[model samples]
Target: MATQQTSAAGDAHGGTDTSPERWVVGVDGSPGARAALVWALAAAARAGARLELVSTYPADFYWTDPYLLDTVRLDEIRADTAGLVRAALAEARRDPALAAVPGAAEVPTDVVVGGGAAAAQLVEQAQGAQRLVVGSRGRSGVRSTLLGSVALHCVAHAPCPVVVVHPGAVQPPPRVVVGIDDTDVSREALREAAEEARRLGAELEVVAACPLEVVWSNIYSVVAPPAEETRARARERAEIVVAEVLGADAPVRLRVEDGEPAEALPRVAAGAVLLVVGSRSRSRIAGMLLGSVALHCVVHAPCPVMVVHPQPARAAGRPAADPAAAAAR
Candidate 1:
């Protein structure tokens, strides 16, 4: 079982029938985790949401000694992890960015330490959370992979949207970029993006990618349409989609680019504070959680990436099984 210690900076904001929204953050004392903590603090403060800081150690650490269950060793590991979470919280309180957001330094917070895989613990803790924030990579991350295993897993299985922040990412202008298509998931992403922009006091940019390619068939070789004409039609379709989802008078900047979605989204989102993408439900292949485009953006986007998963109904059931339990089995 995981142990948790809670601390609050102050009382919850007055006047609310329900409990305050919570934003869960995964911390591991890495530079990447620190970046994530900073972003989460600023966001939580802006939204008046509580922040939960979580850290975990491998439960299998005691497996070498099968005959003896060392409770003392387990307690020491938990204490160390708890201390790390507290240290990260302290540092986040002093971050310049958090200070910039009024009252962000005073957001209420809780610290949770678990004995299990980091991703699983995070996913479990993020239940009913407004968002789950994590570092793009952690200390154990391989240099070659842009995203670490834990971040990817959380993005895949967490019950809420997952925001992955890169360490030392350059702060961009106040703008939220969201990639959209005709899919229902994209519509959800657009709505969430609009809300995020409103909360952050940033402009909203809606982008659609339209790739043009020749059709080669056994019976006929169809040449690709003119670039200008193709672009114009793509723009028209994108405009209609945006209008339908966000109404005709929605205040948003729309852009249609000619390229694959995976490529165009990240390129267009460059220098943006946040890049939002929608992920489809798990695929037929086991352990495959996100679509190619969403996965690509999460791995390559210049700024923090927020991946919104399909709703429960659309997912055909609840979120995927607890990653920690699965790993244990």
Candidate 2:
């Protein structure tokens, strides 16, 4: 295993020194990884953020017995990884897309061996990064991993927000879509989506979903109230989110439908530049890494999905999202 120190070394592209604002992207030479790289480059240009292209492998490549290297030489792996990063950099330079950006010239890029499993390395390396971008699918062994699993891990655990870029997604329309509930995390998502919309000179659409029925499980189940009642309740909840959580001055369009966020959100997000959702929030179905709705959008949204972490504690413990805490903040 290469020492953690060497693993993090950005020596492949000179030294570890990087741009003030950096966005990390895992580059595994897959079509998905390349797409994410392209997106990250354009986004960096827009946000004045630099790019960090990374590829990782098990530590056994260097630390374990020579026989365990699996016929793959460390030097060879390093060269290939560097070459991928270089190609991404070249793409950034040659693409006409970034030519008009004002500060594009200043954003520097670095390629490094993240040194570990794809998800863990990205989450660790992205600690101080502005954002981490990954493609929804990937197909390289050792140095590359499909984002299906890796994207889930990073969105839930990365210190900063995570963006899952879908391959061949049409250029998003002038709008941003967000799913919000009467929860801090959802409110956080709302703000992020709104800000993104504003920055892109697009409309901001806020949606809330309400389940028509309540599942009491194996015990005695109680039927839900009428649709009118549910709609009223959902509307009231959205009002509170807009008033208390979002404040009156925030520019947005609030719409409340059924609380089935997964079903409700993707439809609203259609043709949007981005879909923003909380990793964890107050909802009927929830889990540790990602709430059902967030996961759904990450996998099936029409455009890129930005999973926002509301607070630090839940993410730190990396526990199932707390429903009660939704009101805490």
Candidate 3:
């Protein structure tokens, strides 16, 4: 079994009852990880949710063979991981944004250290969490345009919505942006984005992109529709989606762009506080693969990206996996 430790910060509401809504964050002592911790802290404070900080080390390092185990090495790794989480929590608590929120400094927190693949450990910790936050990249990250393996895995497998925060993402104006299309997942994304915007008291912007190049042909010289007509039709479709999801009188600003969705979304959401996108997958197997637009926004967006998955139906009598057992592997 995996060694574990837990701690709680002072109560935020002057009570002992822990909030049922929990937000789990992965900490790896990297700048990106620290950014994610800070974002999660602020979000938890706003929502009055309990916060859990998790860190992990590779179990393979301390497992010499099927029968032999390096107990001393495993202990050292656990201790180091615990220390890293503690430091991150302390630093995040001191953030001005978190402190700005009422009682944010006193938000309850827990720390967990496990041994296994970092992504699996995080997914295990976030089993019942309201949201899972991870950095777009970690210590092993190389290019800025690429997401780290752990973040990608968590986004694909976490049971709840996943928020990926880039290390250099700045605090933008109070606005939430969401990309939408004719798909059902996009409607879910719009709803999630509207709710988030309401929670943050931010303006909501619904964006739809139409790639006109798809209408053009190379061999037959097919004449594409006029740009204005194409844009008008695109706007109409977006408006219909917005009206269906959020009513006709919903307070949302809609934008129709004449370009690829992957490129237009990030450009339009340049300074927004959060960019909401939906995963175009229905089952767990398909969930492992993100749509091209969603994957692009997560990697290239200038603000925190929230990838909302359609809630899956719960399986009756399904047993939950043991995190400790998973860590021990």
Candidate 4:
């Protein structure tokens, strides 16, 4: 029983350090964990943060297993856990992309044998981490039991900025796709997207997905212009929002489309690394009946998505996003 320590440690690429700056990934025997290992190694190589690969399981079951009194059962569990960890590590090494990472050879791996709940353990490890990377699915849970339970839990409550990587989430020559609208939520999304694009050294793309309103005014149609003009106006409005959130100097490429928010984002992110969207602004009654667009994107987007809560109007004078507060931690 290794005691849990508050102090953090790094991996051996340059000799593990005790700084709280390491990049962490949670690995269980799931497809998502395997993807997370690859993602973590690549990120560690890029960010120069040591990789911390950890696998956690319930320890109570092991200690209380009366059947474990049979030496066979005890040994079997030990062997199974060790094999799972070893396999995960080996799978990571075999990935051409991850194995090719500059620091992949030096990334140290560790196995944590204990259990409260896997999601809780992973979230605990995420605290103080530079970033928390996890695959989209894991062991089952109570409500979202049908989806990737572990990823779902961590996204809702992890202390750090959590990135849930789905298998096909990574895009090439990446672009940052941001959903925009009239509200401050879209403003926050724009700001976050710009920052991420800078981090990944990619281009920022600002997009607005809206439904066209039709009005039957004969005189208005005779003098009014095409829908393209309306779209242009919407685009200009989005540009103002983008500028407000990202500042005049923020690098951005503009795009406007007419479609459902959910459909538009996936299409725009086809070759992008990430999609940033604002949490849906739903009335209490509406939210209970149907989930918002942001929630849907988290579950189904072709790429990783970051959902930001828009600051209240009263907070307009405050900083764009406080790094510490922006992260749930």
Candidate with the greatest TM-score versus the true structure: 1
Q: Write the per-residue lDDT of candidate 2 for residues 1-329, one digit (tens) a residue.
A: 24122222222334545455778888777777777776676667666566777777666445557664654566666666677667666665555655765555445577767456887788778877768999887674322222337777777677778899875344444677788887768866765665556555666778888777666573433454668888888888787776665465556677877658888888777777788898664232224534466777887777888988865553344433232232231
* Alpha-carbon TM-score of each model against the true structure: 0.85, 0.75, 0.84, 0.71
> What are the runs in model 2 whose C-alpha is more than 4 Å off?
1-20, 61-76, 92-106, 140-148, 168-173, 214-224, 281-291, 312-329
List pairs with backbone clashes in candidate 1: none
lDDT of 3 at 96: 74
lDDT per residue as tens, model 1, 1-329: 66656563343543232336888898898888999989988888778888878888777856777542677777777777777787778877898777678877667777788887888889889888879999888987664444448878887778889999964344455778899888878877887787678778777888888887655673443455677888898888878877776677677888888899999998987778889999885543324643488888878888899999887453444332222322232
The clash tally of candidate 2 reads 9
List the global CA lDDT of all models.
0.77, 0.68, 0.76, 0.64
Identify the runs in model 3 with alpha carbons over 4 angstroms from their true place: 1-5, 9-17, 65-73, 144-148, 168-172, 214-223, 282-291, 312-329
**Candidate 1 worst ten-residue window by lDDT:** 320-329
**Which prediction has more favorable TM-score, 2 or 4?**
2
Over 1-329, each residue of candidate 3 has an lDDT whose tens digit, in order, gives 37485774443444354686888888998888988988887777667788888888777745456433767766776777787788778887787767566766777887788888888888888887879999888889665445447877777778888999965444555788999999877877787787677667677888999887553456443566667888999999999988777777677789898789999999988878899998865444533454577778888889899988776442223222222322232
Q: What local lDDT does model 2 show for residue 78?
A: 65
Residue 225 local lDDT, model 3: 65
- Model 1 RMSD vs true structure: 7.9
Model 4 per-residue lDDT tens digits across residues 61-118: 6557777567566556655665676677777867887655576655655544434567
What local lDDT does model 3 show for residue 186?
82
Q: Clash totals for all models, in order?
A: 0, 9, 0, 3
Error of 2 at 297 (Å): 1.8
